[model samples]
Target: MFRLILEEEGYEVHLSKIAFEEVHEVEKLDPDLIILDIKIGRHNEGLLLLQQLRMYRPTMKIPVLICTAAISVIREQEEILQHKGIPVLYKPFDVDELLHIVQQNLLPSETKDC
Candidate 1:
């Protein structure tokens, strides 16, 4: 349902709980946007992958959407992502709000102008 909404909004969304070669492809392709869940498995694995993305050559500066159910670490997460130029999205948020932010951040300046 949520995927359909994002797709309808013209986003080619890819959902994943794993950071593998496919995700590497997303970086290579450089999609207009991305959203990552915080707890892929355990121990805040999202943060680990995020850190790896920062080191990865292609995705280093991509605007990532970090979705987490944890409201406690929002502040800390903000600081980490800010340094790498990645944005975040907290869980239990409206889908529309999520899409709006993703579109706003992911779109190139020229695309936004259009």
Candidate 2:
């Protein structure tokens, strides 16, 4: 679903099944933005991945959007993401909202007209 939506907006999207795969792909692709589901397969694994990214200098400045449905659990980690200026999108999100967020993250600062 996410891949399709992103592709429709002209962004090349890659899908990774697990945290390890995601890290591998991110290193290989150096994507303009990363949309991560906060749970991945293990509880908080996505958050763990984000923490690792923060520690790594090469990937530390890349934009990230934390996607999740577990609002209650997310509230606990909200401050962490907020402090990093990472955006959060709850599950069952509208496509338009998703597209808008993607564009905002991927567009260069000089090119952002919205």
Using TM-score as the measure, the top candidate is 2
* lDDT (Cα atoms) of all candidates against the true structure: 0.66, 0.76
Clashing pairs in 2: none
How do the residues 21-90 of candidate 1 rate in per-residue lDDT, one tens digit apiece?
A: 4447666556555577767775677777777777887877666777778667767667866776766777
Residue 87 lDDT (model 2)? 88
Off by over 4 Å in 2: 21-25, 109-114
lDDT: worst 10-residue window of model 1:
105-114
lDDT of 2 by residue, 1-114 (tens): 987777765666777778864455566667678888888876778888888877777788778888889888789988977887898999989888887787777755422211
Q: Residue 71 of candidate 1: its Cα lDDT?
A: 64
Give per-model TM-scores.
0.76, 0.86
Q: Alpha carbon lDDT of residue 104, candidate 1?
A: 72
Winning model by lDDT: 2
Could you report the Cα RMSD, in angstroms, for every candidate shown?
Answer: 3.8, 3.6
lDDT of 1 at 110: 20
Which residue pairs show backbone clashes in model 1? none
How high is the lDDT of residue 57 in model 2? 75
